[model samples]
Target: MAQRNRTAQGVLAALLAGTVALTACSPPTSASGSANSGGSTKALTVWLQQKPDTASALLSGTYGNSEILSVTQDQLVSVAADGTLEPRAATKWNLSADAKSLTLNLADQKWSDGSPFTADDVVFTLNLYTNPAVKSPLTTVLKPIAGYDEVASGAAKELSGVKKVDDHTVRIDLKNPDVGFMYTLFGATIYVLQKAALSKEDPATVASSQIWITPGKVPGLGPFTLSSYVPGQRAEFAKNPNFRKPVEFDRMVQTLVTQDVATQQLSSGEMDVALVAPTDVATVQGMQSKGVGTVSNEVPGFDRYTVNQRKEYLKEPKVRQGLLTAIDRVGIIKSVYAGQAKPINSSFTSSKVVKDGFATYDYSPTKAKQLLTEAGWDFNREFVIREVNNNAQRQAIDQVVLKNLQDVGVKATIKPVDQAQVTDMLTKGDYDIFLYGGGNYTADPSTNIPMITCANAFPKGANLPAYCDSKVDDLLSQAATSTDEAKRGQLLTQAGKLENADVSHLWIAQPTRVYAFSSKVTGGVRGGDGMFNMLMSVQDWKVK
Candidate 1:
């Protein structure tokens, strides 16, 4: 594959030549670490249509949950909806002896400022996101722990895959043998962050990620404790009296939903939940025809276009399967998500390589001009794609897929770019296709097999089609270090028959994670996976 796009363009020109001051890759935010809305505690208002500038102190640095106010949800480790792994703040863990390694133990943690959740706060958030001056997005999901690539390339300063076997035990160690390494340590980027509550002052709040956009102290142990988050109003999260309250909810009000006017703010009792859209599920079936609320829909996730094989007519795999037979993934999931999406046949959904009854695309602009005239990629020239900012419904689904690729003659357009220039134009292979969306968290393929086999598909993973195939990267490095669930389900069924017969993603449509709650506020559908799994323990959440 042109030596895999010249080794992912020379490891993304050496990780963007370690971007020594181009001054804009942004990401240093929390907008003043929040909490504090309805005075003396007990709130759970919640509503987030995704803005809090996308909060990610890497889920409170490893396993601390809520970031650090004396950890709770009974010490955080919950992941259910049938994928198992329950017990937050950890009251269990200890695997090794050829099972790879794990060890944890914690029990009744603490740290929302009182300290003592130890192993030096998980080796200080694994030496602060394997620090290169904390350039963390959990450094591409903790770059396969086990000496996190020599402490993220600075040739180890610590973190021989985190060790500390004492102060509340710790032992992680797994550069291989990851049959879902306890389901990727039930993600939230494995939470844990503390090292003396972010070194209590001077430049070293994890060395200035401006201590999350200049907010003061965001340390948590979950049961909500945030004090202020006003970016379009409301983020409050009280009741962390060093938590340990179940049936959960002590207080966790999120509220920031910038309207999709689904109408029933948790059934008109003034905000309890929201995310109805499919043009508001017929205003939530007329708020379930006035009896109140409950709307369950499940498809879960997929909405791709990531065709930057390294630009230019998408480095032709028949122009990325001729823009996946020029979209219409079921007429844009039946008129732009009016049915709230579904089509995707493979990228190996819910693993065991999902193929029940295959054969997907059928929108045919005469079979997308006969697969761009059998791979020569024809007159159809519509190319300018980069928009992700102010996503007016992905600019109205790129103005209806650019009038259906200008009615087959092609020549499309959409340069939107903002949200930090869509994460450095999809990690600097600049962009010729990026319309993205791919959250399947842990339902497998280690999340859609890293969106199709492609070994870190160059330029630091998410393989933007600099797609290589050393036998599908030795069967995706033996399905990521093997835990042998039937030999990692026959190597993810040969990496889903080499990712849906190599259509190399244009799959689009699996979607349904819509969330909205407020029927006198009570938490039930509570997240374990997909459809916000009821916002994964939105903490002691209440209103009625």
Candidate 2:
């Protein structure tokens, strides 16, 4: 295996050197002609691992949605490459001393169709998000907003807390003090839609409405405008003429393809940017030695398996705990990730947030058997691993887990479903267990820790495990509302330790995700953080 890895690394280096040589020798201008801006036109092609259901952030939570929207839509605030909050549509935001209210000063901006963007857009978007019919995952994040419950329960048409002070300013009143509100109003997730164009459609159906789904019908306050979309294939975008800032690339395309295909395309110079699978880390690193492309692999991204507590046999905490101990995460990481990952004892990535008393589930076949027997686990029942077909690394990891389960006298099998059907399966509780892998959207624990709370259960938020503990929920709530940073950290640490003991979710390994950007593409952020932040400055990226 080591010999094959070395050979693969060698081949990857040669391919990258050859691709860079070709790019360096090519003509500057395309055969078509110069752009309307009188500059050499450059087009960027990006490969997304999954096909998105819609470009609208309100309607979709797919992996590809954020990448497209990061460039095609504008939010109130954006996180800078250095992890500081920067102004986008809204120039600045100020939180009241009591932390019960937030006032936002809007920037003088126009939508892509030349319509004015105002505080009304902000109010409308916030109220629309609370509409029960929308089924947005953000409802949990925005729960602290005053009047949210009334709007969510269908008792109110508009959120009374969101007031449009004037054309250029808005204020939001909260039911309780929440210091993490800014991060909750994250850039990639909270896009400001134009009220004039979208208010005509019903809030419930707007996400699926033709006006919003159609590429150019609804205008956006972004650097790029959606020009065309081909389901399961690609989405094309053009530079927004009405954008306030100058854009370097005239056009950009996001194509849906598997990770392997993306790697192949990158090596052949057919693709400019794409994610690298864990198994292919060595290959990409070899390519990076030639300096034709940049490889970024950052922490806080994880791979976990969610236990469907709704299942009768899986409800017992011991069963869940036993399942965790049976699999050797360290061995799997070495085998699947080539020692590029670390085993996570709790949901937190930072040691400071992980309480000293946090529970640990070390690999022990004897202990796993004892726990299962004590919980009266059924050995004959099949342990099905529900996962989609898009990620090859996940499939390889699950196979090892299945073998571990079988070794512990458990019958297990992997059920591969189509990527399109994953949402439905998760919503309907159709699986015994499933693989959940992704990065925390922000460094703030409040943004992700609530995912396991009861309020975030499936059909509303991302709590697919359906593991509810009142103590943990209270700690998270207190942490979210506290204005003191130290207090919040302490509360979150307590919650993490409690949930870890309960085995809410089988916390596995924290992965180092690898992404490759072509040498010609400049100004693209590293993929160490969420993918949204990676392309936050897509408009500034230029081809050499």
Q: Please count the clashing residue pairs in each candidate, in the order shown.
A: 57, 0
lDDT of 1 by residue, 208-274 (tens): 3434422336566665556555554445555666554543445555454444432444565455555
Clashes of 2: 0
Runs of candidate 2 exceeding 4 Å displacement: 1-39, 79-84, 288-291, 350-352, 439-442, 528-533
* Minimal lDDT window, size 10, model 1: 1-10
Which residue window of length 10 is worst by lDDT in model 2?
1-10
If scored against the real structure, what TM-score would every candidate get?
A: 0.34, 0.87
Best by TM-score: 2
- Tell me which residue pairs clash in candidate 2: none
- Model 2 residue 138 CA deviation (Å) reads 2.5
What is the RMSD of candidate 2?
7.8
